[model samples]
Target: MLLAMDRVTSYYGKTAILKDFSFGIEEGKCLCVLGRNGVGKTTLMRTIMGLTDRSIGDITIKGTEIGSSPTHVRAKLGIGYVPQGRGILSEFTVRENILLGTFARHDGRPDIPEVCLQMFPYLKANLDRRAGLLSGGQKQQLAIARALAVDPKILLLDEPTEGIQPNIVHEIGETLMTLNRKLGITLLLTEQHIRVARRLGDAFLMVDNGRVVASGPMAQLTDDVIHHYLTI
Candidate 1:
């Protein structure tokens, strides 16, 4: 498995967010986490990265136990995260923002990976532009680029297309598909859109009230499952 969460529970200052969540992702496959808003979709991503106040149970990446590791250590272990709200530094230039991901690299090199630029031409053209001046789609691209700069074996994306224009949403989806199919990068993402999930995911985990209610191959995510667990 590329990533696994075994009976994991997490808390944010005494408020329990996830309850005994268990799931796994195989290498070079995309796993889509599906749920309504506030159902701990983001929390699952945060818990895996150790951003929660406290957590219990096991989280392993590439067969190594990362349950006790800090957030930076998890990042160094090749879990690149493109968090919800597109956590880009507004004041930094596009180039500087991407360079930030290099901090987690074991090789100690600070250069932005060429793959980041090659994948996002807008970023290549606007390397010196301040990140704050970009549009929402551009910012999303920057966030992905920054994560890619880490040269991660797996990517954890939280709503990568949450509020972008429709065209850009499709574009981002295509880009992610290319990354997964061509580059063989493993992906774990939280998605509210069913079409996006079906397009990009090989497996699905349905989260409701911070727990995994149902999980299986993407084909098993029937309309009934969508109606019962995903409908708002």
Candidate 2:
């Protein structure tokens, strides 16, 4: 497995969120995490990235245990996280924001910029524009571009298409598929779009109340399961 979480549990201060959640993804596959709002989807992503400290369990990337590693160490260890809301700096230019991702990463993959530009052409043209000034979709592109700048082994995305328009959402899906197929980057996506998930995911994980209620291949998404926990 390229990335694996075994019996992972997390907390927000005192309240527990995830309980013994476990999942895995290969080097070049995309694993989509699906559920309705406040279902521990974001918590799973955060826990994997060490943004929220894990109360129990283990997270291993490429066979190395990273349960205690900080966020910066995880980034250097090849985990690129694009958190919810596409948190791009509104006051900083596109190039500046992308540079932020390359900061902690010292590997210096020379082709990073080229690959990111290929995935998101809008950022190529507006390299000097302030990120906050861009449209919602453009900001999303920047957020993803920044994460890619790190040359990650696995890309962890939290609701990349949350509030974007339909056209932009489709565009994001296409980019993700291309990256997964062409660049061989494993994608762990937490999203609410079942339509998009069905199209791009090789496997799926469904959570409810911070627990892995069900998981399997996208082809195995039975109607009963979707209606039971996925649909609100």
- TM-score to true structure, per model: 0.98, 0.96
- Candidate 2 — number of clashing residue pairs? 1
Runs of candidate 1 exceeding 4 Å displacement: none
Candidate 1 residue-wise lDDT, 80-160, digit = tens: 999999999999999999999999986778999889989999899999999999999999999999998888989999999
Provide backbone clash counts, one per model: 0, 1
Q: What are the lDDT scores of the predictions, listed in order? A: 0.94, 0.87
Prediction 1 TM-score vs. true: 0.98
Which pairs in model 1 have colliding backbones? Answer: none
User: For residue 112, what is the lDDT in candidate 2?
Assistant: 47
Q: What tens digits encode model 2's per-residue C-alpha lDDT throughout 1-232?
A: 9999899889888888998888888889999998888989998988888878446888999899998988899899988989998888889999989888886565765444688888787789889988888999888889988999888888999999999999999999998888898888899999888899999999999999889888898999888888998666
State the weakest 10-residue window (summed lDDT) of model 1.
105-114
Q: What is the lDDT of residue 177 in candidate 1?
A: 100
